[model samples]
Target: MPETTGDWAPADFERHGHELLATLRQHFELIRDVPVARPYDAAELMGRLDTALPEQGEEFPRILTDTWENVVPDLVHWNHPAFHAYFSTCASFPGMLAETMTAALNVNSMLWKTSPSASALEQVVLRWIAELAGYPGDSDGLLVGGASLATLYALGAARDAALDYDVREEGMSGPHAKVARIYTSDQAHSSVDKAAITLGIGLRNVVKVPSDDRYGMRPDLLESAIARDVAAGYVPVAVVATVGTTSVAAADPLEPISEICRRLGVWLHVDAAYGGLFAFASRMGGEAEDVSVGDSLVVNPQKTLFVPLDSTALYCRRRGALANTYRLVPEYLTSVHTGGTFDFMDLSPQLGRGFRALKLWWVLRSFGRSGLRSRLDHAMELADRLRELAVGDPDWQCPAPSRYPLVCLRYAPRGGVGSGTDLDDLNARIVKELNDSGEAFVSHSVIRDGYVIRVSLANIHTTADDIERLWAALNHAAEKCR
Candidate 1:
């Protein structure tokens, strides 16, 4: 092929694109053979990366080679089959292709007029997600960067809806602002606190409702807290019910919590960042019944749906409330294309948005609902098997119930329960050893003053063999640490 006149000539583009794809293919093929997590000398790696500004452009191929040589080895492989750490993201190939195409187009779909197809596709994808999750047919949603942003946007709408005055126009400067409060489970994600802080609701006003033995929020305690706040002249603005907590993957009792919120007229936001997509796998103990009752819900495709990062959908039943909270039509952005057609900028915090819907659409299309359900079911089965293995072993104790794919277990020797060795210290040692072994990777979380290993199974490539290997690795590491 003849070279074009521009910087990236047609011939060069094709050659480099093929090289990138080939490199990715090779990496994926041998991913399982590499270390799940590896430690690198930070100073040495920094020496390779830290350099003076280049006077001129370097060869693209050399840059790619440097990335492979200097970066790939130091990464904690999240896509590795044995990566049983925090919720693993697979980034399926179809989704990757869609993302590449989206980048090539680089259309900002902030307004419908800016990119009509992108806006329409996003609306369609949002509806599909809501339908899959058993939300109301009338529910409306928008795609954001991730669950943190989604929660913030949802809480912002909730705050405005709860306030008697227009918070968007007047801000939270009035006397009434001092009395506003937000409620969430003690096990809720830190994003809830961040959202409250960003919204001018002091951290003191964020009440943490107690949890039961199973780690699910106690409805009785939540109701009492709300009542006490009301008696103290505090207006409860919103109640965030976590569907899948981070520590142990506990699903809060959403039905009772939603009922209490409804009676109290408090905005209910369900944070299902880790477990919401399980709605499609209802047979494997996934439930969306409680989620259906909430005023708003947030689910992350990036976490569980095999999509790449930054694809979170926030569904709001009260669409008017969201529009009223975030709608800002500046003179420069005014358009005659009105009614029924949505300008996404009106419903989100960002005025310039990428074409995130393309990747989500591709993921859903490639893996139909049944395919996704099958993958989720497989992960649940793996968790069950792991729990069985831990229970069968006398040295291991399963601390929490395996409601989802995340399994929490701790190392407790036969005679070391009340021995001199601190259980937390021993478990920490075991985790460190396991991570350092370069065979498999797992994370740790503290529950009830005890450190427990958190092994999450969400990567599509993980199999029974991988779990068995992890089981062996855990036993070996525990013995070595002991």
Candidate 2:
């Protein structure tokens, strides 16, 4: 007879767990020998794994074997050393361990009463992140799935704070409420638009301010947009300044923008999802562009903190504002007496929250500030070297500025391409060839109506040699395309 579910003996559980871990270790050991991504037939892959469900128990070891042979080989390995694609993420060893523990000790951190350690530790993690980013020590923050959700929460808070009436009870049609307008640069993340839509602020109200030469949001343009919105009888609620723009990592002039917000009485939310790491290492403009200058900001650990995918910290200068924006207490769930402790459920929209703080705690403890700084510095240094190579090469040039470890370059040879040849087509072909070869992977962004290959180096395993390899491959592909 087949073994009953959840009835495995300790010996069986321990043995299978160890074996599975060994298999994973072996896979990483031979990772360098395998392609970054191997193309597979969709129908064949579906046919292999999409079989009919079985009523009987399946052998765990066999399932793992099948996964190793079939599923593992086909995935686009985002953690690979040569993955210079969209903002690389890593499941560092410490984070992996923490994740395992978190799963085993699955507890809701929505309330301190639910899990005291999880909720309390989350606050400590927030403080640690603020300290790392050189942000205001008094700022209160929380960990969410990612920056997208954090942005939504931030704008929601801004919307509520802007309205004189209680938006939580009366909704968007609150008494004496004017249409809310949010301002962000053309280069800012799409999350702003999404947040606007989700919060009843239509896309039309979210003005896309013009960007300057460096792809940063122009402060003067932002001021003008706010002025125009106010004159048109729309309440200028918030301005989102991107610290690391999606296209080129362009940092908006925060000091001037902050000045505008202060003078105009608008909430300023800094989206530092990609560039917040600079605060831990080398920030620009001294105190001028500090993230703390904004009323609120978000920093993503998944981007540069060597953590796993999807963890963002949203911080607010107004300690009670976030709670005021989202707190809803049900009678049965209400505390008998206020214990002077925070109930995380009062913080944001989530009620069933996971123990995400453990991962950051483990990673912070493992790598420490200096170790993380060293890794981030290395990535930036590699980016600088890559830029040097592009500048030194006669056939290539960086179309956009390289502020962070992300750079935008194009294969534009001076007096080399034949007349009537399209530069975009040529550069796209180069990227296609590189991806098809599976040696490396990169993405492209359109800047100045030209296709620019974007190489982002935020992965922990990425090294100078990996950058050199990608550079050589790029040159070879450019030659082939020509």
**Top-TM-score structure, candidate number:** 1
Instruction: List the candidates' TM-scores in order.
Output: 0.96, 0.95
* TM-score of structure candidate 1: 0.96
Residues 1-482 of candidate 1: C-alpha lDDT, one tens digit per residue: 22244477768878998999999999989887888878678899899899899766777788899899888888888878898887777788888899989988999999999999999999999888887777775777899998999999999998888888767777889655546899999999999999988989889989999999999999999999999989988879999989889999988998899889989899999998887778889554544545888899999889898888879999999867778888899999987786678798988778999999999999999989889889888988999999999999998999987578999989989877445779899999888999988888889889984999999998889999989999999999998988
lDDT of 2 by residue, 1-482 (tens): 44776677879878988998898787778766768886678999898889888888877888888888888878888888888887777778788878878987898888888888898789888888888876886787889999999999999999999977888888886676679999999998999999999999899999999998888888888988888878889988899999888888888988899999999989999999988867766533343258888899999999989888767899999779899999889887786436668788887999899999999999999989889888888888899999999988888988776658898889988777877789998899888888777888888888885889999888787778888888888888888888
> Could you tell me which 10 consecutive residues in candidate 1 have the lowest summed lDDT?
1-10
Error of 1 at 355 (Å): 0.6
Clashes of 2: 0
Cα error of candidate 2 at position 284, Å = 6.1
